[model samples]
Target: MDYDDAYANVPHIPDGESYPPRWAAEAAAFREARATDRNDLGVSYGDTPRQAYDLFRPETAPKGTLVFVHGGYWLRFDRSYWSHLATGALARGWSVAMPSYDLCPDVRIAGITTQVARAIQNIAESEPGPLTLAGHSAGGHLVSRMIQPGLLPIDVTDRITTITPISPVSDLRPLLHTAMNAQFQLTEDTATAESPALMTERLDIPTHIWVGADERPVFLDQARWQADAWSCPLRIDKGRHHFDIIDALKDPVSPLMRDILG
Candidate 1:
Protein backbone atom coordinates (compact mmCIF):
# COMPACT_ATOMS: atom_id res chain seq x y z
CA MET A 1 0.00 0.00 0.00
CA ASP A 2 1.08 3.57 -0.63
CA TYR A 3 1.79 6.00 2.22
CA ASP A 4 -1.73 7.43 2.00
CA ASP A 5 -3.33 4.01 2.12
CA ALA A 6 -1.07 2.87 4.96
CA TYR A 7 -1.73 5.94 7.15
CA ALA A 8 -5.50 5.61 6.83
CA ASN A 9 -5.40 2.14 8.39
CA VAL A 10 -3.12 3.20 11.27
CA PRO A 11 -4.95 3.20 14.61
CA HIS A 12 -5.12 6.45 16.51
CA ILE A 13 -6.38 6.83 20.08
CA PRO A 14 -6.96 10.22 21.69
CA ASP A 15 -4.80 11.20 24.68
CA GLY A 16 -7.31 10.62 27.46
CA GLU A 17 -9.00 7.24 27.83
CA SER A 18 -7.10 6.20 24.73
CA TYR A 19 -5.96 2.65 25.52
CA PRO A 20 -7.14 -0.29 23.48
CA PRO A 21 -10.05 -2.18 25.05
CA ARG A 22 -8.27 -5.51 24.81
CA TRP A 23 -5.23 -4.18 26.66
CA ALA A 24 -7.42 -2.63 29.34
CA ALA A 25 -9.20 -5.92 29.92
CA GLU A 26 -6.01 -7.98 30.01
CA ALA A 27 -4.29 -5.51 32.30
CA ALA A 28 -7.25 -5.60 34.63
CA ALA A 29 -7.15 -9.37 34.84
CA PHE A 30 -3.41 -9.33 35.53
CA ARG A 31 -3.79 -6.66 38.21
CA GLU A 32 -6.43 -8.64 40.06
CA ALA A 33 -4.18 -11.69 40.06
CA ARG A 34 -1.15 -9.70 41.15
CA ALA A 35 -2.20 -9.62 44.80
CA THR A 36 -2.08 -13.41 45.02
CA ASP A 37 0.46 -15.04 42.68
CA ARG A 38 2.93 -12.22 42.79
CA ASN A 39 5.78 -14.72 42.39
CA ASP A 40 6.40 -13.38 38.91
CA LEU A 41 6.53 -9.79 40.12
CA GLY A 42 8.21 -6.71 38.60
CA VAL A 43 11.43 -4.93 39.60
CA SER A 44 13.02 -1.60 38.66
CA TYR A 45 16.43 -2.14 37.05
CA GLY A 46 17.65 1.34 36.22
CA ASP A 47 17.77 4.56 38.24
CA THR A 48 18.61 6.91 35.39
CA PRO A 49 17.17 10.40 35.86
CA ARG A 50 14.45 10.02 33.20
CA GLN A 51 14.38 6.31 32.38
CA ALA A 52 13.35 3.19 34.33
CA TYR A 53 12.50 -0.44 33.57
CA ASP A 54 10.75 -3.19 35.55
CA LEU A 55 12.28 -6.67 35.63
CA PHE A 56 10.10 -9.78 35.93
CA ARG A 57 11.84 -13.08 36.76
CA PRO A 58 10.32 -16.50 37.04
CA GLU A 59 10.49 -18.44 40.29
CA THR A 60 12.95 -21.36 39.98
CA ALA A 61 13.52 -20.48 36.34
CA PRO A 62 15.57 -22.15 33.58
CA LYS A 63 15.91 -19.82 30.56
CA GLY A 64 17.58 -16.62 29.43
CA THR A 65 16.25 -13.09 29.86
CA LEU A 66 13.70 -11.62 27.46
CA VAL A 67 13.10 -7.90 27.78
CA PHE A 68 9.66 -6.83 26.53
CA VAL A 69 9.50 -3.14 25.75
CA HIS A 70 6.14 -1.34 25.59
CA GLY A 71 5.04 0.79 22.63
CA GLY A 72 3.10 4.04 22.32
CA TYR A 73 4.70 5.48 19.21
CA TRP A 74 7.52 6.69 21.48
CA LEU A 75 5.10 9.01 23.29
CA ARG A 76 2.60 7.01 25.37
CA PHE A 77 2.09 4.01 27.69
CA ASP A 78 3.97 2.77 30.80
CA ARG A 79 5.83 -0.20 32.27
CA SER A 80 3.06 -0.97 34.77
CA TYR A 81 0.42 -1.77 32.16
CA TRP A 82 2.80 -4.05 30.23
CA SER A 83 4.11 -6.22 33.07
CA HIS A 84 1.50 -8.83 32.23
CA LEU A 85 3.40 -9.78 29.10
CA ALA A 86 6.18 -11.07 31.30
CA THR A 87 3.93 -13.87 32.44
CA GLY A 88 4.17 -15.66 29.13
CA ALA A 89 7.95 -15.62 28.97
CA LEU A 90 8.36 -16.13 32.70
CA ALA A 91 6.14 -19.20 32.65
CA ARG A 92 8.76 -20.74 30.41
CA GLY A 93 11.61 -19.69 32.74
CA TRP A 94 12.58 -16.60 30.72
CA SER A 95 13.10 -13.38 32.62
CA VAL A 96 11.42 -10.25 31.21
CA ALA A 97 12.13 -6.55 31.63
CA MET A 98 9.99 -3.60 30.48
CA PRO A 99 11.50 -0.14 30.43
CA SER A 100 9.73 3.24 30.48
CA TYR A 101 11.25 6.20 28.68
CA ASP A 102 10.54 9.92 28.37
CA LEU A 103 8.16 10.33 25.45
CA CYS A 104 8.78 12.25 22.26
CA PRO A 105 8.94 16.08 22.07
CA ASP A 106 10.10 15.95 25.72
CA VAL A 107 12.88 13.67 24.43
CA ARG A 108 13.57 12.86 20.81
CA ILE A 109 13.58 9.31 19.43
CA ALA A 110 17.40 9.26 19.56
CA GLY A 111 17.35 10.00 23.25
CA ILE A 112 14.66 7.42 23.85
CA THR A 113 16.65 4.75 22.03
CA THR A 114 19.66 5.61 24.14
CA GLN A 115 17.66 5.11 27.33
CA VAL A 116 16.46 1.73 26.08
CA ALA A 117 20.08 0.64 25.67
CA ARG A 118 20.91 1.75 29.20
CA ALA A 119 17.93 -0.13 30.59
CA ILE A 120 19.12 -3.30 28.89
CA GLN A 121 22.66 -2.78 30.10
CA ASN A 122 21.48 -2.32 33.68
CA ILE A 123 19.72 -5.68 33.53
CA ALA A 124 22.54 -7.54 31.80
CA GLU A 125 25.22 -6.31 34.20
CA SER A 126 23.32 -7.82 37.12
CA GLU A 127 21.87 -10.92 35.43
CA PRO A 128 23.95 -12.43 32.63
CA GLY A 129 23.56 -14.66 29.57
CA PRO A 130 21.60 -15.31 26.36
CA LEU A 131 19.45 -12.19 26.38
CA THR A 132 16.77 -11.75 23.75
CA LEU A 133 15.06 -8.41 23.16
CA ALA A 134 11.47 -7.99 22.01
CA GLY A 135 9.04 -5.11 21.68
CA HIS A 136 5.70 -4.25 20.12
CA SER A 137 5.00 -1.38 17.76
CA ALA A 138 7.04 1.64 18.85
CA GLY A 139 8.75 -0.45 21.48
CA GLY A 140 9.60 -2.81 18.65
CA HIS A 141 11.20 0.07 16.81
CA LEU A 142 13.28 0.96 19.85
CA VAL A 143 14.62 -2.59 20.23
CA SER A 144 15.75 -2.47 16.60
CA ARG A 145 17.94 0.46 17.60
CA MET A 146 19.84 -1.82 19.97
CA ILE A 147 20.59 -4.31 17.21
CA GLN A 148 22.53 -1.78 15.18
CA PRO A 149 26.30 -2.48 15.49
CA GLY A 150 27.33 0.87 16.92
CA LEU A 151 23.93 2.22 17.88
CA LEU A 152 23.95 0.64 21.35
CA PRO A 153 26.60 0.76 24.05
CA ILE A 154 29.17 -2.01 23.52
CA ASP A 155 28.45 -3.88 26.75
CA VAL A 156 24.72 -4.18 26.03
CA THR A 157 25.16 -5.53 22.49
CA ASP A 158 27.54 -8.32 23.42
CA ARG A 159 25.02 -10.04 25.71
CA ILE A 160 22.00 -10.15 23.41
CA THR A 161 21.59 -13.48 21.57
CA THR A 162 18.72 -12.56 19.32
CA ILE A 163 16.02 -9.95 18.68
CA THR A 164 12.35 -10.28 17.78
CA PRO A 165 10.40 -7.11 17.13
CA ILE A 166 6.70 -7.65 16.58
CA SER A 167 4.80 -5.18 14.43
CA PRO A 168 7.64 -2.66 14.67
CA VAL A 169 7.73 0.73 12.93
CA SER A 170 11.29 -0.06 11.75
CA ASP A 171 11.10 2.70 9.15
CA LEU A 172 10.51 6.12 10.67
CA ARG A 173 10.09 8.09 7.42
CA PRO A 174 6.63 6.69 6.88
CA LEU A 175 5.43 8.06 10.20
CA LEU A 176 6.67 11.55 9.27
CA HIS A 177 3.89 11.86 6.70
CA THR A 178 1.23 10.07 8.74
CA ALA A 179 -0.96 11.51 11.50
CA MET A 180 1.60 10.09 13.99
CA ASN A 181 4.00 12.87 12.95
CA ALA A 182 2.02 15.39 14.98
CA GLN A 183 3.25 13.74 18.18
CA PHE A 184 6.45 11.99 16.98
CA GLN A 185 7.81 15.32 15.58
CA LEU A 186 9.98 13.46 13.10
CA THR A 187 11.95 15.30 10.42
CA GLU A 188 12.86 13.67 7.13
CA ASP A 189 16.49 13.52 8.19
CA THR A 190 15.67 12.22 11.67
CA ALA A 191 13.34 9.66 10.16
CA THR A 192 15.96 8.36 7.76
CA ALA A 193 18.64 8.12 10.41
CA GLU A 194 16.36 6.50 13.01
CA SER A 195 14.81 4.06 10.57
CA PRO A 196 16.10 0.47 10.64
CA ALA A 197 15.52 0.10 6.90
CA LEU A 198 18.12 2.79 6.22
CA MET A 199 20.34 1.42 8.97
CA THR A 200 20.48 -2.10 7.52
CA GLU A 201 24.19 -1.75 6.91
CA ARG A 202 24.55 -1.61 10.69
CA LEU A 203 22.50 -4.69 11.58
CA ASP A 204 24.84 -7.42 12.84
CA ILE A 205 22.63 -9.66 14.99
CA PRO A 206 20.17 -12.38 14.02
CA THR A 207 16.68 -10.89 14.17
CA HIS A 208 13.16 -12.09 13.56
CA ILE A 209 10.44 -9.85 12.14
CA TRP A 210 6.72 -10.48 12.56
CA VAL A 211 3.54 -8.49 11.90
CA GLY A 212 -0.22 -8.99 11.93
CA ALA A 213 -2.05 -9.71 8.73
CA ASP A 214 -4.87 -7.36 9.68
CA GLU A 215 -2.64 -4.41 10.59
CA ARG A 216 -2.89 -1.20 8.58
CA PRO A 217 -1.33 -1.36 5.17
CA VAL A 218 1.34 1.05 6.35
CA PHE A 219 2.31 -1.25 9.21
CA LEU A 220 2.37 -4.25 6.91
CA ASP A 221 4.47 -2.30 4.45
CA GLN A 222 6.82 -1.24 7.19
CA ALA A 223 7.17 -4.85 8.34
CA ARG A 224 7.76 -6.02 4.78
CA TRP A 225 10.45 -3.44 4.18
CA GLN A 226 12.12 -4.25 7.48
CA ALA A 227 12.15 -7.97 6.75
CA ASP A 228 13.43 -7.40 3.23
CA ALA A 229 16.15 -5.04 4.35
CA TRP A 230 17.43 -7.31 7.10
CA SER A 231 16.84 -10.48 5.10
CA CYS A 232 15.56 -11.92 8.38
CA PRO A 233 12.82 -14.49 8.78
CA LEU A 234 9.37 -12.90 8.65
CA ARG A 235 6.32 -14.46 10.28
CA ILE A 236 2.76 -13.29 9.75
CA ASP A 237 0.05 -13.96 12.31
CA LYS A 238 -3.17 -14.47 10.41
CA GLY A 239 -6.29 -12.55 11.56
CA ARG A 240 -4.43 -10.58 14.23
CA HIS A 241 -4.65 -6.79 14.14
CA HIS A 242 -1.77 -4.49 14.92
CA PHE A 243 -2.95 -4.05 18.51
CA ASP A 244 -3.77 -7.70 19.12
CA ILE A 245 -0.77 -9.37 17.50
CA ILE A 246 1.40 -8.70 20.53
CA ASP A 247 -1.13 -10.44 22.72
CA ALA A 248 -0.23 -13.69 21.00
CA LEU A 249 2.89 -13.72 23.14
CA LYS A 250 0.59 -14.48 26.08
CA ASP A 251 -0.16 -17.83 24.50
CA PRO A 252 2.74 -20.27 24.47
CA VAL A 253 1.75 -21.87 21.17
CA SER A 254 1.04 -18.63 19.35
CA PRO A 255 2.82 -18.16 16.04
CA LEU A 256 4.30 -14.87 17.22
CA MET A 257 5.45 -16.39 20.50
CA ARG A 258 7.01 -19.42 18.85
CA ASP A 259 8.86 -17.34 16.29
CA ILE A 260 10.49 -15.28 19.03
CA LEU A 261 11.00 -17.97 21.67
CA GLY A 262 12.50 -20.46 19.28
Candidate 2:
Protein backbone atom coordinates (compact mmCIF):
# COMPACT_ATOMS: atom_id res chain seq x y z
CA MET A 1 0.00 0.00 0.00
CA ASP A 2 1.12 3.55 -0.63
CA TYR A 3 1.95 4.64 2.91
CA ASP A 4 1.42 8.28 2.08
CA ASP A 5 -1.96 7.60 0.44
CA ALA A 6 -3.02 5.33 3.28
CA TYR A 7 -2.29 7.87 6.01
CA ALA A 8 -3.25 11.02 4.14
CA ASN A 9 -6.43 12.60 5.58
CA VAL A 10 -6.66 16.37 5.29
CA PRO A 11 -5.79 16.06 1.61
CA HIS A 12 -8.68 13.67 1.08
CA ILE A 13 -11.16 15.88 2.90
CA PRO A 14 -10.50 19.37 1.61
CA ASP A 15 -12.11 21.04 4.60
CA GLY A 16 -10.39 18.85 7.20
CA GLU A 17 -8.91 21.55 9.45
CA SER A 18 -12.29 23.23 9.70
CA TYR A 19 -13.86 20.17 11.30
CA PRO A 20 -11.98 20.55 14.62
CA PRO A 21 -13.10 24.13 15.20
CA ARG A 22 -16.66 23.23 14.20
CA TRP A 23 -16.66 20.25 16.55
CA ALA A 24 -15.37 22.48 19.35
CA ALA A 25 -18.19 24.94 18.73
CA GLU A 26 -20.76 22.16 18.77
CA ALA A 27 -19.33 20.79 22.02
CA ALA A 28 -19.63 24.24 23.59
CA ALA A 29 -23.23 24.55 22.46
CA PHE A 30 -24.04 21.06 23.79
CA ARG A 31 -22.60 21.89 27.21
CA GLU A 32 -24.50 25.19 27.42
CA ALA A 33 -27.79 23.42 26.73
CA ARG A 34 -27.09 20.84 29.43
CA ALA A 35 -26.33 21.34 33.11
CA THR A 36 -22.65 21.69 33.91
CA ASP A 37 -23.67 20.80 37.47
CA ARG A 38 -25.03 17.43 36.32
CA ASN A 39 -21.66 16.52 34.84
CA ASP A 40 -18.97 15.17 37.11
CA LEU A 41 -16.37 17.12 35.21
CA GLY A 42 -12.61 16.75 35.55
CA VAL A 43 -12.61 13.73 37.80
CA SER A 44 -9.02 12.59 38.11
CA TYR A 45 -8.14 9.15 36.80
CA GLY A 46 -4.42 9.46 37.27
CA ASP A 47 -2.07 11.85 39.06
CA THR A 48 -1.57 14.11 36.05
CA PRO A 49 -3.90 16.92 34.95
CA ARG A 50 -4.57 15.52 31.46
CA GLN A 51 -5.45 12.11 32.84
CA ALA A 52 -8.93 13.17 33.96
CA TYR A 53 -12.43 12.37 32.63
CA ASP A 54 -15.83 14.04 32.35
CA LEU A 55 -18.96 12.05 33.07
CA PHE A 56 -22.37 13.45 31.98
CA ARG A 57 -25.63 11.87 33.04
CA PRO A 58 -29.23 11.71 31.93
CA GLU A 59 -32.37 12.78 33.87
CA THR A 60 -32.58 9.55 35.89
CA ALA A 61 -30.38 6.60 36.66
CA PRO A 62 -28.72 5.63 33.41
CA LYS A 63 -29.16 2.19 31.84
CA GLY A 64 -25.40 2.10 31.46
CA THR A 65 -22.34 4.26 30.90
CA LEU A 66 -20.74 4.91 27.51
CA VAL A 67 -17.25 6.41 27.34
CA PHE A 68 -15.92 8.14 24.24
CA VAL A 69 -12.18 8.69 23.66
CA HIS A 70 -11.42 11.57 21.33
CA GLY A 71 -8.92 11.12 18.46
CA GLY A 72 -5.94 13.25 17.46
CA TYR A 73 -3.68 10.47 16.17
CA TRP A 74 -2.38 10.14 19.73
CA LEU A 75 -0.87 13.60 19.28
CA ARG A 76 -3.55 16.16 20.23
CA PHE A 77 -7.19 16.85 21.20
CA ASP A 78 -9.01 15.82 24.40
CA ARG A 79 -12.31 15.45 26.32
CA SER A 80 -13.43 19.05 25.92
CA TYR A 81 -13.45 18.59 22.13
CA TRP A 82 -15.98 15.75 22.19
CA SER A 83 -18.84 16.65 24.58
CA HIS A 84 -21.24 16.99 21.66
CA LEU A 85 -20.69 13.34 20.76
CA ALA A 86 -22.65 12.33 23.85
CA THR A 87 -25.85 13.80 22.39
CA GLY A 88 -27.37 10.61 20.91
CA ALA A 89 -26.30 8.15 23.64
CA LEU A 90 -27.47 10.51 26.40
CA ALA A 91 -30.88 10.89 24.74
CA ARG A 92 -31.18 7.10 25.05
CA GLY A 93 -30.71 7.25 28.84
CA TRP A 94 -27.02 6.44 28.87
CA SER A 95 -24.45 8.40 30.83
CA VAL A 96 -21.53 9.44 28.63
CA ALA A 97 -17.97 9.89 29.86
CA MET A 98 -15.21 11.60 27.88
CA PRO A 99 -11.65 11.15 29.04
CA SER A 100 -8.58 13.06 27.90
CA TYR A 101 -5.23 11.36 28.20
CA ASP A 102 -1.70 12.80 27.96
CA LEU A 103 -0.69 13.03 24.30
CA CYS A 104 2.25 11.26 22.72
CA PRO A 105 5.81 12.72 22.87
CA ASP A 106 4.65 13.81 26.35
CA VAL A 107 3.69 10.23 27.21
CA ARG A 108 4.19 7.26 24.90
CA ILE A 109 1.20 5.50 23.28
CA ALA A 110 1.46 2.60 25.71
CA GLY A 111 1.58 5.08 28.58
CA ILE A 112 -1.56 6.75 27.23
CA THR A 113 -3.23 3.33 27.05
CA THR A 114 -2.48 2.68 30.70
CA GLN A 115 -3.79 6.12 31.64
CA VAL A 116 -7.06 5.50 29.78
CA ALA A 117 -7.51 2.11 31.43
CA ARG A 118 -7.00 3.86 34.71
CA ALA A 119 -9.55 6.48 33.66
CA ILE A 120 -12.16 3.82 32.93
CA GLN A 121 -11.43 1.98 36.16
CA ASN A 122 -11.73 5.24 38.06
CA ILE A 123 -15.19 5.77 36.57
CA ALA A 124 -16.24 2.18 37.24
CA GLU A 125 -15.31 2.48 40.91
CA SER A 126 -18.35 4.71 41.40
CA GLU A 127 -20.70 3.94 38.49
CA PRO A 128 -20.47 0.12 38.79
CA GLY A 129 -22.48 -0.95 35.75
CA PRO A 130 -22.15 -2.25 32.21
CA LEU A 131 -19.91 -0.01 30.13
CA THR A 132 -19.37 0.64 26.44
CA LEU A 133 -16.43 2.43 24.76
CA ALA A 134 -16.37 4.26 21.45
CA GLY A 135 -13.43 6.13 19.96
CA HIS A 136 -12.26 7.66 16.70
CA SER A 137 -8.84 7.37 15.01
CA ALA A 138 -6.08 6.89 17.56
CA GLY A 139 -8.66 7.12 20.32
CA GLY A 140 -10.24 4.08 18.69
CA HIS A 141 -7.05 2.10 19.13
CA LEU A 142 -6.87 3.08 22.82
CA VAL A 143 -10.45 1.90 23.56
CA SER A 144 -9.93 -1.47 21.92
CA ARG A 145 -6.72 -2.05 23.85
CA MET A 146 -8.82 -2.35 27.04
CA ILE A 147 -9.64 -5.89 25.91
CA GLN A 148 -6.06 -6.78 25.00
CA PRO A 149 -5.88 -9.73 27.37
CA GLY A 150 -3.66 -8.63 30.28
CA LEU A 151 -3.83 -4.89 29.73
CA LEU A 152 -6.62 -4.20 32.25
CA PRO A 153 -7.77 -5.66 35.55
CA ILE A 154 -10.47 -8.34 35.30
CA ASP A 155 -12.94 -6.16 37.16
CA VAL A 156 -12.70 -3.35 34.63
CA THR A 157 -12.55 -5.75 31.70
CA ASP A 158 -15.66 -7.58 32.86
CA ARG A 159 -17.64 -4.35 33.02
CA ILE A 160 -16.90 -3.42 29.39
CA THR A 161 -19.62 -5.10 27.33
CA THR A 162 -18.90 -3.58 23.95
CA ILE A 163 -16.23 -1.66 22.07
CA THR A 164 -16.89 0.50 19.01
CA PRO A 165 -13.72 1.63 17.19
CA ILE A 166 -14.45 4.18 14.51
CA SER A 167 -11.86 4.64 11.74
CA PRO A 168 -9.06 3.30 13.94
CA VAL A 169 -5.71 2.16 12.68
CA SER A 170 -5.72 -1.30 14.19
CA ASP A 171 -2.23 -2.05 12.95
CA LEU A 172 0.31 0.51 14.12
CA ARG A 173 3.11 -1.25 12.24
CA PRO A 174 2.31 0.64 9.07
CA LEU A 175 2.55 3.91 10.92
CA LEU A 176 6.18 3.31 11.79
CA HIS A 177 7.06 3.75 8.13
CA THR A 178 5.61 7.26 8.00
CA ALA A 179 7.43 10.54 8.65
CA MET A 180 5.22 11.15 11.70
CA ASN A 181 7.33 8.45 13.37
CA ALA A 182 9.42 11.32 14.68
CA GLN A 183 6.58 12.16 17.03
CA PHE A 184 5.37 8.57 17.69
CA GLN A 185 8.87 7.16 18.37
CA LEU A 186 7.60 3.57 18.08
CA THR A 187 9.93 0.62 18.03
CA GLU A 188 9.01 -2.59 16.21
CA ASP A 189 8.26 -4.25 19.55
CA THR A 190 6.17 -1.40 20.94
CA ALA A 191 4.33 -1.11 17.66
CA THR A 192 3.36 -4.78 17.85
CA ALA A 193 2.60 -4.57 21.55
CA GLU A 194 0.29 -1.58 21.12
CA SER A 195 -1.40 -2.76 17.92
CA PRO A 196 -4.97 -4.07 18.44
CA ALA A 197 -4.69 -6.00 15.17
CA LEU A 198 -2.00 -8.17 16.75
CA MET A 199 -4.40 -9.07 19.53
CA THR A 200 -5.39 -11.96 17.31
CA GLU A 201 -7.33 -13.82 19.99
CA ARG A 202 -11.03 -13.18 19.51
CA LEU A 203 -12.51 -11.35 22.48
CA ASP A 204 -15.51 -12.39 24.57
CA ILE A 205 -16.90 -8.86 24.49
CA PRO A 206 -18.53 -7.89 21.21
CA THR A 207 -16.49 -5.52 19.03
CA HIS A 208 -18.19 -3.26 16.50
CA ILE A 209 -15.81 -1.71 13.93
CA TRP A 210 -17.02 1.34 12.01
CA VAL A 211 -15.44 2.60 8.79
CA GLY A 212 -16.54 5.48 6.66
CA ALA A 213 -17.32 4.77 3.02
CA ASP A 214 -15.83 8.08 2.00
CA GLU A 215 -12.65 7.66 4.04
CA ARG A 216 -9.26 6.88 2.51
CA PRO A 217 -8.55 3.27 1.57
CA VAL A 218 -6.03 2.79 4.35
CA PHE A 219 -8.55 3.79 7.02
CA LEU A 220 -11.07 1.31 5.60
CA ASP A 221 -8.40 -1.40 5.37
CA GLN A 222 -7.42 -0.89 8.99
CA ALA A 223 -10.93 -1.66 10.31
CA ARG A 224 -11.60 -4.41 7.75
CA TRP A 225 -8.34 -6.17 8.66
CA GLN A 226 -9.28 -6.36 12.31
CA ALA A 227 -12.83 -7.59 11.63
CA ASP A 228 -11.63 -10.40 9.42
CA ALA A 229 -8.97 -11.37 11.93
CA TRP A 230 -11.56 -11.60 14.70
CA SER A 231 -14.31 -12.97 12.39
CA CYS A 232 -16.66 -10.14 13.33
CA PRO A 233 -18.88 -7.95 11.17
CA LEU A 234 -17.80 -4.60 9.73
CA ARG A 235 -20.13 -1.64 9.17
CA ILE A 236 -19.36 0.71 6.29
CA ASP A 237 -21.09 3.95 7.16
CA LYS A 238 -22.36 5.21 3.83
CA GLY A 239 -21.49 8.73 2.64
CA ARG A 240 -19.39 9.48 5.73
CA HIS A 241 -15.76 10.58 6.02
CA HIS A 242 -13.10 10.37 8.72
CA PHE A 243 -14.15 13.57 10.49
CA ASP A 244 -17.94 13.84 9.97
CA ILE A 245 -18.69 10.14 10.42
CA ILE A 246 -18.46 10.88 14.14
CA ASP A 247 -21.53 13.09 13.89
CA ALA A 248 -23.58 9.91 13.89
CA LEU A 249 -23.01 9.78 17.63
CA LYS A 250 -24.50 13.25 17.90
CA ASP A 251 -27.77 12.20 16.29
CA PRO A 252 -30.10 9.89 18.23
CA VAL A 253 -32.11 8.68 15.23
CA SER A 254 -29.36 8.09 12.68
CA PRO A 255 -28.49 4.66 11.33
CA LEU A 256 -24.93 5.18 12.54
CA MET A 257 -26.10 5.58 16.13
CA ARG A 258 -28.49 2.61 15.78
CA ASP A 259 -25.68 0.35 14.59
CA ILE A 260 -23.40 1.50 17.40
CA LEU A 261 -26.15 1.20 20.04
CA GLY A 262 -26.78 -2.38 18.99
Could you estimate the TM-score for every candidate? 0.86, 0.96
Off by over 4 Å in 1: 1-5, 8-25, 28-50
> What root-mean-square deviation over C-alphas does model 2 reach?
1.4
lDDT of 2 by residue, 1-262 (tens): 6776669798789788898898889888888888777788889888889989989998888888898998988988889889989989988888999999998788899999999888888888888578888889998898888887776778877888889899988999998988777889999999998888888654588888998999998889999988887676789989999998898898878776665665
Model 1 steric clash pairs: 6-218
lDDT of 2 at 71: 90
Summing lDDT over every window of 10 consecutive residues in candidate 1, give the lowest-scoring window: 9-18
lDDT of model 2, residue 42: 86
lDDT of 1 by residue, 1-262 (tens): 3554565433332232444555657765765665444333344544543476666666665477888888877877777677667667777777777778888778889888878887788778767667889998888888888877776667677767788888888888767766657777889998998998778466577798888887777778888888898888888879877766777777766666666677
RMSD, each candidate, Å?
A: 3.4, 1.4
For candidate 2, the clash count comes to: 0
